[model samples]
Target chain A: MAGIPKPKLNAGQRKSQRGTEEAPFVKWLLITVALLFSLVFLLLPLVNVFAQAFAKGFTVYWDALKHPDTIAAMKLTLLVTVICMPLNVLFGLAAAWAITKFEFRGKSLLVTLIDLPFSVSPVVAGLMFVVLFGLQGYFGEWLADREIRIIFAVPGIVLATLFVTFPFVARELIPIMQAAGSDQEQSALTLGANGWQTFWYVTLPSVKMGLLYGTILCIARCVGEFGAVSVVSGHITGKTDTVPLHVEKLYNEYQGAAAFAVASILALGALLTLGLKTWLEWREAKLETLAQQAEQAITQ
Target chain B: MSIELKNITKQFGGVSAVNDVSFTVADGQLVALLGPSGCGKTTVLRMISGLEMPTAGEILVRGKRVNDVPVQKRNIGFVFQGYALFKSMSVADNIAFGLLIKKWAKADRDARVAELIELLGLKDLAKRFPHQLSGGQRQRVALARALAPKPDVLLLDEPFAAVDAKIRQELREMLVNLHHELNVTTIFVTHDQEEAMEVSNRIVVFDKGRLAQIGTPREVYEEPASEFVARFIGVMNVLDCEVREGVARCGELEFPTHGVADGQRLRIGFRPYAVQVSNDLMAYRHFAVLRHTYFLGVLLRLELEFPSGLIIRARMSKEEYARLNLTEGRKISLQIRQYRVLAREGELLPPEVSVTHHLGPSPGDGI
Candidate 1:
């Protein structure tokens, strides 16, 4: 048996119908374009830095690592990260708990203020700290007379880095905490658990993975923070220089090999961060799978 | 273990969720708070568990007031409707949670956890997380977790509502057995009437934020106190009727009634199974066949049309069907075997007033 003839299409009809047939190809083209852009902007820079670092063989890289100024910069960066990461994590947890677990006026306003650092430029963030603690700024004379220097010092660098990194942990933690509903806490309360006990036992365990992931991100950002720390540290060669500040100074002073050497360390740190991120993402995926399974089991 | 709720009322905003409700649950007895959604049965359970506080009233547990006492100090255990198991913990660890919070010794806590694992049939799944367990297994784990600490009182809010039908039946039986074995003052909340009837020794029916009735399940089902209770407990057919000389007159028929004055209009109700259907044409019973017949596995339900054009359901067993050879479109005579009269509007009456009257066959006599 023969089939019926298909409907005919006009020019306008064919033009309008073209998109649906080419939709998949269009999507693939868009993704490929984005991937190529990211490769040019991101991966190429890291590969260039590695190539530059190894241009004069490993001797120059080893000599740069042995340099006292480079050692001091690395130590300062490590110290700031170790000190600031935990503080940010703690404050982030407190802020998230306050925003999610309690009902108060101006909650949305407070949350916006917590997210202010993300929108603020790092240089402007450093300038704000300078305006607050510089020689002519508020509390400047008192701190200066007391020999407790803040601006143009390590303290200023740490402060600016901390200001820039504050929102990283909190921003990551807030949504995770919000998605875990209040049922478990209420259950704990009804089962004779006090407020502290409920939070410690029920609430903490549920958000532990998210909290750890956010803390790791905060540490990574604090260690790699450049523009803000540069403006505040004054780039004193062996006194207040962080890794990024030292790299900038070396690059400007015709020390291209040394700059790439230092840049390679930051690249390695970024790689470690990528690994941590992957681990955390795997954990999140596992949690989601388990949740879906639980839902299916309940329905069944 | 006696719990007294004195004029307890809870309001959200200006709307009352539980309004001026008062009842006592005796020690070691299981009471089911039965109602439809938004009727405040779950709210009442929550208030009693201290998850929610009443807007006005006092709660006394074992003769001492506990309205101001925190949940932890009150020593109550709650099994939520969703189970709410800690996903991070294994079944054994979940059951050991309350004991650990109480600072029980490690050895003692482990022993208690082991005991509950065996008692709840979770020994095989002891090391498995909640996400790894089946629905029935999860429910058993929740029950074990709630009961591990030997709480002074137990509260369950629709604990079996999330399970499948077959599992719900099994869980209901297990709940009844656990209640008896533990002898803890327990209050179970559910909207399913069959669940309440099966699991509770006494049932407290609520309607629109108020207590409708509190009685044994048998009494509530067999001798409901009001129209609402009668209609809610089981399948009751209500019809408009007039009382004359202690008898109800309905659509060319008169049946014996009690406590209804003459010339008074009232609503009358009877259970579907209480109706007697017969195929004998010589019988002088007062009924007409309506349009449809519903065949339930063990019983056949017939929809009867009276001369007043009112439809009523009459339930006949399989044996009765075989005896009468009943089928669709067949004319069958129905006799009102038992019924109750309810008061109409503007009549000064008790909150729950019903006049039960049985005509024709005596109790336990079948057609």
Candidate 2:
């Protein structure tokens, strides 16, 4: 038998034969385009907000932060978050548990309804509350008879914000809970744990990471919401205005420094959320690696 | 009876999952619900454990009807198919979960967990989370957890289905030993016939949501009441033949009609071990050429091809194969020593010939 001689090639041909990657020039061109795209659309706007806020002297920026209206807006924002976070978390947990852990009629439709907020326009969400609670809306006469106000007030602002951010936590939890399955809960039940005990000890702990991730996202979204809160706030500065609505009011009144300064706070909140998400991903990966090492040690 | 299921039927969205299934497990006996996947064996186990409700039946646990009882209150330990060990809890915590739920004192809970850890050989894994343990280790932990509460009855769903073959064999032996030591009324579901036969004292076979047979392993293996059981339990060569004159003829193979009407179609099944092969072509009345040989460790499976395009599986020892110089494509003579007339699909078996009958050559029949 004759031995087949190996083929020889130059460096250029050898590189082409190594993999299915594009040519060097094409690869670099694509990377350059993507980097420039992010720079223009993402990095530029963020840098501009901080840059414009500090363009004035430090005293001006500090004064903008110290303004009574800005303080009220910050407080209102925090108040809305405090009121909405727990409600949303409880609702999200219930919704996700029902959808993932059991089979019933209209389950897929319920999942779609939970995601309705994400797809519906924020202004429409605001209008939905207005139509329900406004003076001319249904149950409006009964509410007016009781002298309770909802639309065009702080309560209205909270309601609109809740509608817009309703799906965040539930969306994050559904896939996590679905993937983990109902087996552990069933196992807990078979071990003499009642329904509540199974949920607390087995289901909740398994999905805590996803729940935390979702809470961070929901808080970030709730704090930064604009269109819905603005529609329902009636531009009542120092009373009903959240951080986003107040920022818009400041910019509209030619208070550019104050608006940019207020905007930077929300930007920082987003940065912190991103950092927390990264930390969670890192910790989860590290835990997975440790588990793998333990398993390998057993085999060894 | 320790547990009795009477006329148990389960329907999912109008489709029957289990239909008219009835069985009883004596106290301190290990029984296996054996069937293929989607055969409702797992559903039967779940209904017994009170995790699933039977659509129309009565489940009696130690002579008490428990149809409406919740799973937690049923006091039945259930091991899920996937083990389902709490990923967030350590092995000791998982085993102690049941004991704590029962309001046992901390000391007693710890003592029980320690005893189970020692019994299941999980001493070092007590502190490790479920993710850190191996598949076989996780299974042992699940078993220990289910057993920790000292429930009167224990049910397992495909307990060894997830492990590798070698570990599966080891786990089967461990379960047998554990059952012997703890003498609890145990019922386990498995699709592996060998596991069911090796682990349980009694086997209840299922076919398409109905109870096909319930008997000892030997009875089910030797005298399968239906055609499905005969094929599902082990390797059996089933042939469709028509009786002509005094014999049932299937291509080149013939069996005694066993009192069947002439020209009537009959089904006969014979085990591979019943196939007797001789090196001399004239030794037996029938001849076939060896086509393929499969090695199954100690036993050799031979596929023999007759002239009429019929193939039959035969098993022989390695020593006999070597002594007779049997190889593929070699001609050999074979005879079927025993076979049974299998009941047709959905038909009841005739009591007389349901058991296999031995046949000898007829007198004055020239070879």
lDDT by residue for model 2 (B229-311), tens = 88778777777777889687887899996677787777788988899999998899999999988887778888888888788
Off by over 4 Å in 2: A1-10, A13-19, A293-300, B280-284, B307-309, B322-332, B344-367
Model 1 agreement with the true structure over A1-300: per-residue lDDT tens digits: 359887798897876755447676787999999999999999999899999987788999989878999999999999999889988988998999899888899999989999899999998999898889999899899898999989899889889988999998788779978987787788777666788988888888888888888888898889899888877888889889998888989999998998999989999999988998898899889878987886687567
Binned by DockQ into CAPRI classes (incorrect, acceptable, medium, high), candidate 2 is high
Best by lDDT: 2
Clashing pairs in 1: A192-B72
> How would you encode candidate 1's per-residue C-alpha lDDT over B189-294 as one tens digit per residue?
9987778887899999999999999999999989887777776776776666777898777665576776768987777778888877778756746757745776
TM-score against truth, every candidate: 0.88, 0.91
Expressed as tens digits, the lDDT of each residue in A1-300 for candidate 2 is 369777898898876644777878998999999999999999899999999888897888899998999999999999999988888999999999999988899999999999999898998888888788888989788889999889878899889988887898899899999999899999999998988999899999999999999988889888999988877788888999999988898999998988899898888898889999999999999998998998898888
